[model samples]
Target: MVLGSAVPRRRLLLVALLAAVVLVVAGGVVATRLVGGPRTDRGATPVLTPGPSTPASPSTTPSPPPPPPGADITGPLNLLLVGVDTRVSVPGWEPHADAVLVLHVPRGLGRAYLFSLPRDLVVDIPAFPKAGYRGGRTKLTHAMSYGSRVPGRPKQPDTAQGYELLRSTVSGYTGLRIDAGAVLTFNGFDRLVDSLGGVDIYVDQRVVSRHRQPDGRHRASAPGGYTGPQMVYEKGRRHLTGWQALDYARQRYIPGGDYSRQRHQQQLIRALARKILDQGLARDPDQVQQVVDALGDTLVYAGGGRRLVEFAYALGGLPADRFVLVGLPGSSVGSGGSYRGEQLTTVGRRFLTELRAGRADAYLTKHPTLKVKT
Candidate 1:
């Protein structure tokens, strides 16, 4: 009797997992809707370009070389997806890239790999023209901020320039040519989740908020009229609303810190994808349009709206098992170190080499533990 009960429960879980995978593929396609309007053959997708003026370079700061002549993206396609804290319009504010993911879609679109780069990864940033800033080693997230900053110019945001700079920085570090890129605002992500009527994700562990109160206090308990920070999520299956999903994905107070948050972020993507598929958004043009509309003006992509739509459509049929998730191997430097940062491990170098050579599957086979289950 016990064995029979276990068998049914396991079967149910398997079915749910399969359903989630299908939804994720559908969701990935719909997520591209955030890029632009209905697909039309009117023109090529808009490409991001650098600003006209060049920044004065210091002796130590070397100018970035021009990108190699455009080559037809054959074989695997690499896309840099950056998640920023807020839309660029906030006056005098330079938003950092809170999340950076490299989405690798294999040649046949048979499988997809998502590799997450922690925000604190130490990397070299190139000088920006408008900013008159010399390049230096800094947190990977700061690459966007340095690119966007334009001293002696208007304080408004220049997302295109920022993305271009970040693209260059990532390309330099990864040794892979970035075919396209996307900048997604956190607020936009929240709305996308809400539009799908929320998502169901399996939380692997408890998640506590690390965001501080206005008075610079870590809200740990409700005392003296203080409610403290809420425990955003507890371990197990959770059907999260838009705001709750965002909070859950953003939490870094767990055991793994940013690494834990990175996993959650990737999980959220898969969950959202699953929700979209389960809701049949792919077949309903009106529903798809609604999802696009909810994204508003927040999503900015390198290729025009059409390219994203086309790419998403092409890969929509991929199964969930075909999706693989891995983090760039790295260890964080302690706070008191000369520079509190993260250094990529030797295995990370091997992973990058395999990725560049289109052998990520082999790498995964050798390092089975890195494969993240959706």
Candidate 2:
């Protein structure tokens, strides 16, 4: 859908930029409320603490070609992009890190690599004094739930707090200091899709959603799980509404399970980004404010140290072809067994090492299997 015209070119570009910058992350249409707004957007904004020490890797990330004339930020930028599975439909389900990604923009900013972290990967979670609970080993997804617990009231869940601990765990795991981070709710993702008039995604595999039914209403809940007619996505390209797009990416019961779902999530992100870019909103100014107004209450982006708008300008020049999707399996040999959690394959761990050392491009070239085919 194209935005209205009439605004100044500068104003139009700024608003259109929010669309590209946010969608360029993990879930595509995920992230914050773009500009300053109330917390009611249903999007969770997490402030980035001085999370981890930047690795001593050589500074070789190319200064992404100069952005538009006014852009400033440059160099290797690492953003922790997280999509939370907050089942607000259920009264007591705390959100977990459903889609965890590390978006590393090289020094040149010419290309960006998106690294997907397996949610179930088992790891040692450090203690968060705020939660008043000693950390323990568990699935990486649990980091969000653990961090979200209220200090004195354990039953209350605070996404902001949860995000902080998740950020810390991920920083420790990757050994890359995050410059910024964002956590977008799944419900908000739906709103974003609707705002953009739905998105189109290519289904790589047939997936039967475990949560939604054919009519789009959630299936009836049972002791084991939801039971009823399931919504199915056939393999191919499909134009999807908000529910369809979200349901398609939310599936984890398929062959690759969450790992496969990660690929789908990445695809969905790109599709949304493509949809926005295809509209040519970046060039037109007329209805740009209307587009921004439509998205006003949908996102809640939090820059690590910079304002969200500045990022819009900085990333405005990213070429569509420059986005590279790197998918890593969470487990090497545990999918068939009982699930304590997941572990990154040896290759996955090695990739992180190469990433920190500014050798990601070479390492990815050496291991072609690491790059997920779009």
Candidate 3:
């Protein structure tokens, strides 16, 4: 079925800017500066590969033009976006997938659907021959860490290899073949926002910072928790600095907890989409060029075979309005007191079924509640 309507030409280009200038791991948007910092192996290609192979077609005498709207699509391109939670750069640090978002964009490339898997979701991560990880049942966040272990050097963990293993785990869990993916450190997320001169977001709730002090310095440690006055993000439409946006997106102590954090993260990306248009970054070639150059510092990507810019251009037809934030419902899994992790409910599993079956448009219509409110 058809998804997004006729997108204005200019806005379509901006959406590409959203993917290129800002960072999109597949899900609507990820949170933090996205942790791992600049790599020592920056020039080396990240070994990104896709699974559940595609149908091989004979070499065309002349390459065919891209499929048009309503035409058969070659993909159900499942992209894995994982935000790494680490204070140090890759290899030196063992990181987890702090925020996991899976973006499913159909072969049609007409529109895309972004959904999140709770970091605390409990699952059995399978064996990884690369990292020598045997795997076990634990929070999904740990999958990255387990996969990141540098086999020979125990102190160093390869984050790229980490994504490789996390990818396999996610593909198995969701039953969606991950075609392209990215591993963004918390640090990268903030730089992107600041590069855009900050974003204007309508904060849905009041969030008191648990990490930062009133003056923007990190809070001091205390017996039970952190000390000093906290930075507060008052409820309303306000311009968010990079640090502020990251702080807000990382919060999980609010009423809705992690779910609230997820929603706000989604909102941040939407705001970023609007900010690019409002700030006119999409139209400025020089400014856009700067963002492209700086983007490599922000996060590392695996295009499954293609370059990141190629993916950006291929999905350029996608407009900002077409990004659908899908919310999956589930509850904590554990005993009376201690918490174990999380597992998706039947409704959540059903969504994945429809996603793989290429019927998300119809599924979303039937269950409007599943769509995160814009």
Whole-model Cα lDDT of every candidate shown, in order: 0.61, 0.69, 0.68
lDDT tens readout by residue for model 3, 238-351 = 888778888888899988888888888877766675555444333333333333444554545444334444454345445667788888888889878988988888888899
Model 1: per-residue Cα lDDT over 1-374, one tens digit each: 12223334433222222222232242321222122223342344332244576667675665675432121223366777777767445676786888888777778766778888889988888887766658898889988888777666657656556667787888899888776666655534445455556688899987766544434344564554436645456789888776677777777767988888888888887766555434432332222223333344433333432333344434444555567788666887766656578878888768888987888888889988677666
Per-prediction TM-score, please? 0.71, 0.77, 0.76
Largest lDDT belongs to which candidate?
2
Better of 1 and 2 by lDDT: 2
Query: How well is each residue in 158-209 modelled by candidate 2, as lDDT tens digits?
Result: 7777878888898899998776677766645565576666777778888988
Lowest lDDT sum, 10 consecutive residues, model 2, at 33-42
Q: Candidate 3 — worst ten consecutive residues by lDDT sum?
A: 27-36
> Whole-model lDDT for model 2 versus the true structure?
0.69
Best by TM-score: 2
